[model samples]
Target chain A: MAKRSTVIAITVAAAVVIVGAVGAGVAVLGSRDTGGAAGAKGDTTVTVRVWDEQVASAYEQSFQAFEDKNPDIDVKLTVVPWADYWTKLRTDVAGKSAADIFWVNNSYFADYADNGDLLDIDKTLGSDAKSAWAPSVVKQFTRNGSLWGVPQLSDAGIAVYYNKALLKDAGIDPASLENLTWSPDASADTFVPVLQKLTKDAAGHTADDADFDPASVTQYGYNAGNDLQAIYINYIGSNGGTYQDGDRFTFANPKTVEAFQYLVDLMNTYHVAPSAADTNQNGDFSRDQFIQGKMALFQSGLYNLKNVADGADFDWGVASIPAGPEGRVSVTNGIVAAGNAATEHPEATKKVLEWMGSAEGNEFVGASGAAVPAVTDAQPVYRSYWENQGVDTSKFFDVLKNGTIPAPQGANFGAAFGAYGPILEDVFAGRVPVAEGLQKAQDAANAALDG
Target chain B: MKWTRTLLVYLVLLTGAALTLAPFVLSVMTAFKTPEQFARRSSLSWPDPVTLENFGVLLTGRTEFGRAIVITVLAALLLVAGQLLFSIMAAYAFARMRFPGRDALFWVYLSTLMIPAIVLVIPLYLMMAQLGLRNTFWGLVLPFAFASPYATFLLREYFRGIPQDLVDAARLDGANALDVLVEVVVPLSRPIIATVTLITVVSQWNSFLWPRVITTGNDWRPITVATASLQSQYNGNWTLVMAATTLAVVPLLALFLVFQKQIVRSIAITGFK
Candidate 1:
């Protein structure tokens, strides 16, 4: 009898304590919010967001210069790692709480601009301001007759990185690698023979030897896999096949089929490249293998220049990407700094954006050797920085003279990749025939984009 | 036959233990290697000349991982204290009292566990932004300081299984409700309480998504977010990342060491083992 009353009393007291603590927590949180806003009282604070920590550090020095000239405005940089950058940006923009300026890639620009989330660059910075940046990035960002972002950085072009000692051991001259060209016709091909000479079996036999055992391969000659940017897309373009045409997949073209067949045969037939079973799941497998001195040739871009320079303990040199039947055509991708359309501090934000696009401001990125600036005039600093390290930067830049294809540019490109990624993985692993796989992948990619 | 069966069981258990411990062993091994050594050698290989450089870079360099550890500790401590206190009181009420709509209210609160956390991210982010709490310590910890549905449910079920005679005897011995709770209920519920505390601390420590969305700068960022920043877009720096990971995991491991006995007893009593 006494227990029931005791239980009631305890329940009442507990309820009061629970409610009181929650109320206090909310009160403290609310008060702190007010304090934070009030603390930024003197100068209008404009925030900038980026994904790369290296670029963020470089921009810290650049923005310090910006803040020195404009004493009344303060700039703060926020870095989100690449894994969460898109997710957080989408949520923040939808909530109307994104930074005044944030970096956007080509694949995501169309979505943000279509949703009216980005400030129209042509309208904000005038159409004449486009001349200050690289024409390729400007063209990539321009849609429906208005520019969407200020160009921040560009991937110059793809190039070949060779392990000099490995090439020498294989009796292959590094200089010959520059002029190596491939063709679908085996009689006309000069590239595979070079790779075959570099590859070896466990019994110290090169792949070209009659006694060479494919199962016991100890060294690979090249990195050929399902890598879209580094391996297959460049091959597709160089072979006169198209991967995309006006926001749709065109990978089922006959030339694209021939290119895939050549790549698959390099892995499954000739065994000059690592098996696709290894490289399909791990995108960094080829780069790591090259750095480990197990592979002779690695085709990648400026993104990997510092990776190889810092990671490799052996001597290495950069050379032009092997040309195909048509020519050496590489994919050129770039990143842009887009402004918030509804930013509260429009004047301050525009000032920050304008400074980011200028040659003096962009030079900080190039001078640090973190990336090549999109501003053409600032590119010399990047070249000179690499030259000081004894690396020839022209290998990356020289390919730009022949021709280039833009990186995937539709808003649905990510969705399209998701739909076709597994099929491509199967195709690369040689479980699916090349022609049939490309057709299935093309249909799936187009369905995803058109849906 | 008995000896052979026991030997077989021991072999299986040893194999399982090795498989479980392999990745953690590799992470620690990798953390002690230089970047070049990490890329050159097999992942399972031991560091030849073990270096402190990765730790030095993580703790003293621009990553400022030491500061992140301090912030994570403070947030986890606050969250554990608040969550345990409120959850205990709430669970006790739901178990003992026969109030109006008590079961209905309890059921309604527990139903929230069915809703996914991803659905709440946008709304919660908007609320915090409107309050000007973005990038602030309060923004990172405040939303999670209250009683969670899962914790409350676990505690309530355990409280219900406690003998009612214990409470009645305390009442007859001239003890008030508060005395009965502090001296009787809590003293006997040590194992479950320890379990709750450990669970709260570990979840709050390893929390990534909410903290990633809430804080932006290093000033208020926690260890999980800072550890993620060790890898840039282009560079993996696996050795450096593994170092940061090893540092972030030490406190949780220490906590487990301290409370292993009570946690095991809780698992046994709850029939979860």
Candidate 2:
């Protein structure tokens, strides 16, 4: 009986696998009737992929407008979360199942462009289409003497979002906050003094007071931490130093080292900013503090604009990031949409891609205050939408015009960033000296780039 | 002296239980909170105005939380049924059948358990894509609905432990293999079968990575995939996340409640808990 039962179980298990496989095969046959790659199969449906849910609604509206205009062509937009976007896209591209049109960031596009996974924009749109958009954005997507994507939106500057009530209680002028300047030498710098003035102990003494206790700071004066984009990147570039020289990290530069040291000193020496422990443990520590009214000024990208706008109960305003010895040079980055080279319906995909690059399509996103559209003409609507929300978002644009630097970008940038990010954490945490950390980081970045 | 030892054991068990159940308790509490209430209050606090707005949003949102629940339940059912059927057959063959590679094949099959799923995803995904199974219902359930080594190993051992005298007695009565299996061995292996069924159901219900990778469209996306997508980088929508998490967990909790006796019986009989 036992032997017989074992045989029956084995037979049953094998039968189930066989049946499952056969079922899958039957489904495959049915799927083949839908044509290849998209909507209704043989009928013309173009798949478009994007990563941001905050802007997905706007894209859906934009795609609807496109579909209305081009009734023959159906567009399907899928929003992959930011975390899974690149991984899914990479696998899809490898499998030749990528969307007809999808987003391509500067750091990631080079591999696709190099491997001929992306459709050439120059071939699709021509010289006239290229010249109409922002010059820098056009330059960004241009790879191997051919443009690979159309820039949808650009994010370049970091503005200080200050709690109005915090500044008010600190007796600090909002106007003075805009031009606050930092230098390697504390006595020569104006930024540290402003931070010192804003910071207060539980015993009612400001950081400027000799009797002030660092242990019981009720409100932090500033958020200076390991955030490369909003904090250290601005400091590095604004101090006449650059984080990256082309593809290789150049933070070991004398001025770059000075910038890092002075910034680290704000936390360790002056005791104005939060410790590396707090910042290192939580990515959103500063933003949370600012919204909770524990922070005076939070310098960050417009990516957090919606979160701050919706979350804050206190009155808030935006000001340009503090200047260094040279000037306020915030790093700007852009998001672009690329057409898949391996798409089955090239002509249909091209038409969809063209619409994505058009101001008419981008206008939906801009008008809804989804993001700052790359099409210069559509930007006003985006600004006005935020203004209508009773928040002046013009500070980002204002700071963009003030000697801005491009965010670090190159073929091996993604790899290099993964290597150096943790190495610098030690420097920020005071475990490693800035000079030694920068040196080790430079080597690591170059090694990753070599690969 | 005996009471002291009992008290110590109770203390240890209570602590372990609290530690294990704390996250779920927090999730349930947060699910009832408004976004502002969640952010402002302590994690341990009761919701001042208990609301179901988060649940309402998830259920009605474009992701279609209701559809995900239905899909997950269907997949879990299919998976458990198929897995048990296949695992039992394979285990029975290995234990009692006289195939040439019986021992060799069993060892080989067992070795695959040591291989990581990550190493297999690419090739398996390619195979599924070639089979045109991606985004289909079967794609979500079929890859996982077969005889796993662990399942086969467990059942094979239980089958071997069945008495040879019982088999001889059944055969003496002119019982065929199928009749003997259905009437005798299957009845004797109830505890092990129940245990396998529970494990299969739980694993299938909570399966995330496979569903996320396989299903591009939400037509076949399970609740785990849907729950994960709710989390954005910037918006700390903890209340909404907790609601989705609580919703994902409720089915498993209900399943446990329904099968509590069988599960306990299986554990006691197997003596493997």
Question: How far out, in Å, is residue A17 in model 2?
Answer: 16
iRMSD per prediction, in order: 6.1, 5.6
DockQ of each: 0.33, 0.29
What C-alpha lDDT values do all the predictions have? 0.86, 0.82
Worst 10 residues of 2 chain B by lDDT: B35-44
Instruction: Tell me each candidate's TM-score.
Output: 0.90, 0.91
Chain A TM-scores, per candidate, are: 0.91, 0.90
TM-score of chain A taken by itself, candidate 2: 0.90
Candidate 1 residue-wise lDDT, B1-273, digit = tens: 999999999999999999999889989999999988888878878897899999998888777787788678768767877788789889888888779999999999999999999899878878889998887777898899889887888888888888999999988988776676666786777778887888888899999999988987566788989988777766678999899889988987887788788878867866788
**Model 1: native contacts recovered, as a fraction:** 0.41
Error of 2 at B258 (Å): 0.9
Candidate 1 residues A205-268, lDDT tens each? Answer: 9999999999988789999998988889888988988888878888799999999999998999
